[model samples]
Target: MNIASKIFNSHSKEDGDFFLAMTRILGFKPRKLGVYKKAFLHRSVNKRDKKGNPLNYERLEFLGDAMLGTIISKHLYTEVPAGDEGYLTKMRSKIVSRKHLNELGKDLNLIEHVESKIPKAHFGDNIHGNVFEALIGAIYLDRGYTYCEKFIHDRVIVPYVDIEQLEGKVISYKSLVIEWCQKQKYSFEYEVYEDTGNDPVKHFGVKLYINGKVMAKARATSKKKAEEKASKRAFYALQDRISKN
Candidate 1:
């Protein structure tokens, strides 16, 4: 073979190996391997292309996010024809919530292929979902929308999207409580303060108030968690009214 052909062959073989590895994870052969590689590459690697632009999965993640939103929105629109804009949007958000996506990534063990300088253990739970989204982004870029949609259907919708179950799934209790309060024209606030108690870890306490009435109280390691816990309690307390509305 000529020099150029020999080099091409070597590169192709390497790409083939990557494709095989991804196939084992994805349960199907990918039409384009470059996207999967980009998905797994962590920003810490500091890789750059010949054009001097930094190369990582962040850009792909953005694309993947858009694609996922579009597909889920379409699914919701068709499945729940009676749902208005707000209802559909909230349903879509729940499906693509960070917690749900993180769980999906963990279930697939997508982090196993991440190329990062940092130790894997040091990485937070969000990394798995981030990589998974980046992979979707890559798939869209390499194989076009059709293949990307197919991959999402196979990996996400088929396995996870249950319309009835999702309707009751609470993506964010705090957000829900806040929305309900606003809709009902009730003043609501989450009072968060440093919690110094006998505990191994630092904690924050939250008191949820609705129209000057204390609805619920809770504590957690972080302000967000504290708020969520408080909101969850508030939800249960006002479950009857919330359900009616």
Candidate 2:
């Protein structure tokens, strides 16, 4: 029997909805509803299995991450015969970047099915990516590697993994800025300060300084994001110098 046939034989409306949703996303039936359920379960629910193992998607997320990396690696190895280890690694990073995964989840509307105690609006951007990874893990566990591979190939690889475009994609602007500064032997610093936004959400401001010169400034909901934003601005400011090196 398929996932819905064996696992979702009940008359619960929620189960029916979940079955249909999984079918739409996976382009096939899911074997174990409970397995996929745990994929979306938040730790805040405080549930546990018969063996007393914690019930949450974290472990599944780890497995999915590994699967994504392994499958992407194989594709890169075959497609880019000229790529060295470092080049292939970088390309894979670009394809599976957090931002890209978050986009994928958003495209699939995965967050709508998340069962969490916290309000959906309160969740961070990474929640989308986390569930996406967890879904991959659930697929692996439900039907094994072949189905897992097919799901990734259809949902992730075919639609988004473009080597030619990815070559120019910069996953992290902050990393690029730091690399450029290091290569050119220029000292740089990201000076952070309290953000003055009146919004309820916390914010941070950062100023990117290169050789005692203020290159760019930006503000965001988190320090890392603020720094990255500042670095992006700094990159454009020094694009010519950075690109040549």
Considering every candidate listed, which one attains the maximal lDDT?
A: 2
lDDT by residue (tens digit), candidate 1, 17-102: 66656766665667656668889999999999999999898999999999999988988899899999999999899889999889
Per-model TM values vs. the true structure? 0.63, 0.66
Q: Evaluate all candidate structures by whole-model CA lDDT and list the values in order.
A: 0.81, 0.84
How far out, in Å, is residue 190 in model 1?
40
Q: List the residue pairs that clash in candidate 2.
A: 3-30, 3-31
Candidate 1 weakest ten by summed lDDT: 2-11
What RMSD does each model have against the real structure?
A: 12.5, 10.7
lDDT score, candidate 2: 0.84
2-59, model 2: which lDDT tens digit per residue?
A: 5455444755767878887877777887778788888888887888999999999999
Q: Once model 1 is optimally superposed onto the true structure by TM-score, how far is the C-alpha of residue 67 displaced, in angstroms?
A: 0.2
